[model samples]
Target: MRARHGGPAFRRLILEDPACGFDARDARVTHNNPNEEHGRLLEACAAGDHGALQTLYRLEGARLLGVVQRIVQDRALAEDIIHDAFVNIWTKAHTFDAERGSGKTWIFSVARHLALNHVRRQYREVTVDDTTAEQLDAERSLTASAEIEDTFDWQGRGDLDRCLKALEPERRNCLFHAYVDGYSHSEIAERLDRPLGTVKAWIKRSLQSLRECLS
Candidate 1:
C-alpha cells in the first residue's frame, strides 16, 4: 500500500488489530538486544510477515506516537501520522539495510519526517494578516509563559539547509522553533529567554533571508 492517509481502515486492512495477542508493556523489556531483534522483525516484515509488523507496533507504537505528538501537538493528527508511518514502513521494509542504521532509528525517522512535513504544510498554508498576527501576539503575551525549546533538529528543503546554516545559529533556531516545531512567538521567546519582540524580529528577518537565498 502507498501509505494510506485514511487512518483506521488502512490500519485494519494492513495491520489487523495489532493488539490481538501482544501486550505493549511486555514488549518493552522482553528482549536482551532490542536493536538486533528490531532488525530481525523488520526483515520478517519485508518477507510478508504481518505478525512481525504487529510486534514492531507493539514495541514502538507508543514512543513513535509520543515523538509525533510533540511535533504536531494534536492527538488525532499524531495518531494519523503513526498509521501512515506504519503503512510506509510495511511497504518500504524491503529497502531497509541494518548495516547502515538501526531499525528502531529508521522507524522513528519515518514518523518524524511525516510529522514535520505536516507541520510545514500547515504553516505554509496559513496566511495571517498583520492585524491577525498582532492579535495573536497580544493574546500570547497575556498568557502565562510556558517552557519551550530553543532549537531542534533542522531539516530544510534542498538548498534551504545551506541558507539556514549561513544565518546565525540563534536566528536559524528561531525559524525552526517557529515553523518546524510550530512554536508561537511567545513560546519561542520564553524558550530562548529573549524578549517576545526580539523573537518575532528574528523570525521575520530569517524568513526574508531564506526567501532571498532561495529566490
Candidate 2:
C-alpha cells in the first residue's frame, strides 16, 4: 500500500534530514520508554489527533530512516520512503490491531515494507549470493509475531552477526528475502528457483537456528 501525500508542514516534519532537526537520542532524553507509548499514541492518531502523529514522528522518525537507508542505500530516496512510511502510518493508523503486534512494530513494518518495495522495483534481479546480508537487527521489531516478530537485542548476543554470517548464503538469502525484502514463501521460491516447500522449510530451519544461536 502506498502513502498519500501529506500537507507541507507534515512533509517538512518528515522529509527533512534527521541531522537538521530530530535525533533519536534527543527523543530518548525526555521519553525513557518510547516504545511503551506507541500503542496509546497510535490510537490517538487513529482518533484524528495530528499532535499524536507528530509525537510518533519525533520518537521514531530518525530510527525509521536508518532502517530504510540501510536497505535502499540512498540518503534522499530513503528519506522519501520514510516520508511515505509516516504518511501511511498516519493514514492507516486505524487499521492497526494491538493484538497483532506492538505499535512500534506496526509503524516500523510500514516503513520497512515501503523500502523493500522500492528495492524490489529497482533491483529485483540482484542476487544475494556470497554477499553478507544486512543485519537481522534491521528486522528485530517484526520478528516478535509468529509469522514475523522478535526482539532485536543484538548487543545482548555478541555473536549474533557471526551466527547470521555462519548460515549458508542460499539459506541466508531466503531469510532476507522473506523478512527483509518482505517476500512471501511462494514468491521467494519462484525467485530463487527452489520448490515452495523447500523455501518454507529453509526459512523455518534458518529461524530456528538463529534462535538457538542467540539462546
Candidate 3:
C-alpha cells in the first residue's frame, strides 16, 4: 500500500507486511546506545547527509507512525502525517539545538505536533461556531504567552523524572497533556472537564514548579 507512492528502493524498504508493522524491537537492536546514536544521526542530518535521514526514518518511522495513529486514529492519515513530519525534520534539522533537549524528543515532537494539528483542525472545522472559534484563537495566543519559553535540558537533569512524579496528579496531568499530547489550554480543559481558566492556571504553575524542582 505504501509502495505506490515511492521509488523502487523506498518501496522495498517500506514493504514489510502491513499486518506485522515496523518492528521497533529490531530498530532498537540496530543501535547499542540509542540516545548517542540518535544524536549522531541528527548531527549528520544537519550536515546535509541524506543517508542519515534515511537511517533515522528506518529507526524511528514505526514509532512515529504508532504515535500519529493513536492521535489521529486513522492509518492512512497517520501515514500521510508521518511523511510530512519527516520532510519537516529534514528541512528543520539545522534548527535542532542539542542543549535544549534530546534529538529523539525533538523528532517525536515534530511528528506529534503534526498529528495534533491535524486532529485539532478537523475538530475546529466541524464543531466550532465563529464566536467560539475566535475565543479559542485568542485563548491560544494567551496560552502561548504563558508557556515556558526556555526549553529545559530534560535529559541532563537526573532528578527531572522524580520531580515530575512528585507533582500533584491534576497538575501533572495538565502538564503532560500540554507538552506530550500537544493540547491547548482549552483542549486540556475540555479533556479534564475543568474550567478553562483553571487549566491555564494549572499549566502556568506547573511549568514554574517544574523549573524550580529541576533547578
**RMSD each, Å:** 9.8, 11.9, 9.9
Candidate 2 stretches greater than 4 Å from native: 1-33, 126-204, 208-215
> What's the candidate order when arranged by decreasing TM-score?
3, 2, 1
Per-residue lDDT of 1-215 in model 2, one digit per residue for the tens? 22223346544665344467543442322465566689878898899987778888887888998888766666767888887898899899999988887899899999998877776774444444211332322253234233322222233434567788667677777876666545666577677656555666678889999998888
- Comparing 1 and 2 on TM-score, the stronger one: 2
Whole-model Cα lDDT per candidate?
0.74, 0.69, 0.70
Best by lDDT: 1
Report the lDDT of model 2 for residue 198. 61
Rank list by lDDT: 1, 3, 2
Point out where model 1 deviates above 4 Å.
1-30, 125-215
What are the per-residue Cα lDDT tens digits for candidate 3 across 104-192? 88999999998888767655523335445546556564554432322322334555777776666667777766665556667776776
**CA shift of 47, model 1, Å:** 0.3
Residue pairs with colliding backbones in model 1 are: none
Return whichever of 1 and 3 wins on lDDT: 1
